[model samples]
Target chain A: MSNEVEETNSLKLVTPGHASSETEGRSVDAGPGDADCSPDGRVPYMMSQIQETLQTLDTAVDTILGKVEELHSKYEREGLAENPVLDACREITFACCFHDLCSQRLNIVLKSLEEFGDELTDGSNGTREEASILASVGESETRSATQDVQGGGSLLNGPAMTGEGLSQEDVDELLKSFEEFN
Target chain B: MAVDKNMPVLIVDDYSSMLRIIRNLLFELGFKNITEATDGREALKKLNRDAYGLIISDWNMEPMSGYDLLVAVRKDEQMKKTPFIMVTAESKVENVVAAREAGVDNYIIKPFNGATLKQKMKRVIGDF
Candidate 1:
């Protein structure tokens, strides 16, 4: 609802859609209440009325600026300024989401495989293995979200895994040793 | 006994990254028929719907915990014998003893790599 400050700046509610388009803030002709706008575009100092109008306008501008600043702050945090840290954070978040997507895709494929194999019916053997592996030693449950890469046991501590291939002599010596054993 | 690459395995965890990490490690170890779940309750639902050869689960979860799930599965006649491995960060001695007593086939401490995972799998389900 637009608060129609009438010819005289006493704030009053206009009957919403019923207010005439032109009577929104000004009348076709000057009336006793509109002595400040005597058919000229110039604004007159209507003392108390002018002060109240200025205060309202100031308040409205502040509200709008507050909203704009909030939006700007949000954009800044989201890397609208091309901040490297924010960009990295966003990439990490996206990578995590990608991880979930891939995991879900794997689950979907497994589900379809199960339905297709239908181990009880004919051709079930395609997915089935010997029953020995399925035997329980014990039973449980759980998922979620990874970060800490603590080597909690001796397993991760034994070696610094390298992607680089071994030296030619190392490979030759290793193959020769295997050949001798064979 | 030789482990079948196609043997259906169920892995449960709530974290997607951890889930992906475990799945990738399993894939590297040649296990293709893998299923995933976010928690014990969901895992149990899947367990009832189908059969899985092995279960790798985490200890901490909501609604139903891995420990509780282990107890429930051990109590259930149909699922009591299924191999279970606890892959989690819960490394306290008491927790390990409790899991052993509950019949857990193996326990894997967190931050493990493919080699670590493979060793645990070998201990629990034989060589793949």
Candidate 2:
């Protein structure tokens, strides 16, 4: 009976090995799980992801710009600048401006994200201080976002300026309005 | 009143791509003398510095919007006579009304082709 009791105690001690093995299995599944466990690592990883996306977008914009430039030069050299083909190309080129506009807006988003990430990883201060810092960051981000939307000091609003083409009625109205102004 | 194709035109937009696009379109239209500004402030500075025959500007910009630029241009004694075309994506009646009220010579919506631009230009500045 005493031998049996000793054997059960040995099994109980070995049971922790199973738990440790299970933990190891989980860790393996996580694959660099430390990043997931630590805010510092995770935030940076997220930032890198955003940077990679921005790089891809930048590459796409560059490619479009190159292709359009090539097309423009070809047309110019051929003296086909007045042709409908050139007209279509011009439209394509204008459409490509979307890339630059998107890039600017994305940069704003990236900046805000980075600031938030920094706040999340900042562990040097107490909770209260961190909260205050975060609040300030939030305020600044809000201001910038508002400025971006408002077009700041620029004369143009954002995408709102890119709405559908005006109608004949709209044109007539504009002309009539112009007459009133004059 | 025929538009002088030789007249110096100012193209304004915040995006370099937009500026380039507009510049190319203008080039195709036989407008040889062209000036470029990235924003309304720069456009205003250029307007003050040189006598632009026409101003084609995007409606949305930072620091100064196209509408604001038009207002400023209209208020200025020297620049008020300059034919101003507001290029925008806004088809809203209110916006058009506001632009007209601001004394814009013409308006062009986005995704417009060269022919459309030419027609608008002709309307504003007469046959170019």
Among the numbered candidates, top TM-score falls to: 2
* Cα lDDT, model 1, residue B118: 77
Off by over 4 Å in 2: A1-59, A80-88, A100-157, A160-182, B90-94
Q: Give me the candidate number with maximum lDDT.
A: 2
- Contacts from the true interface found in each model, as a fraction, amount to 0.04, 0.32
Q: What's the CA error at residue A111 for candidate 1, in Å?
A: 35
Report each candidate's C-alpha RMSD, comma-separated, in the order given.
Answer: 26.3, 11.7
TM per prediction = 0.43, 0.64
Backbone clash count, each prediction separately: 17, 19
lDDT of 2 at B32: 82
Task: Give Cα-based local distance difference scores for all models.
Answer: 0.56, 0.68
Model 1 lDDT, residue B11, Cα: 94
Residue A57 displacement (Å), model 2: 4.0
- Give each candidate's interface RMSD in Å: 15.4, 5.2
> For residues B47-111, what per-residue lDDT tens digits would candidate 1 score against the true structure?
99898899999876666677777877888899999999886655554455566667787776554
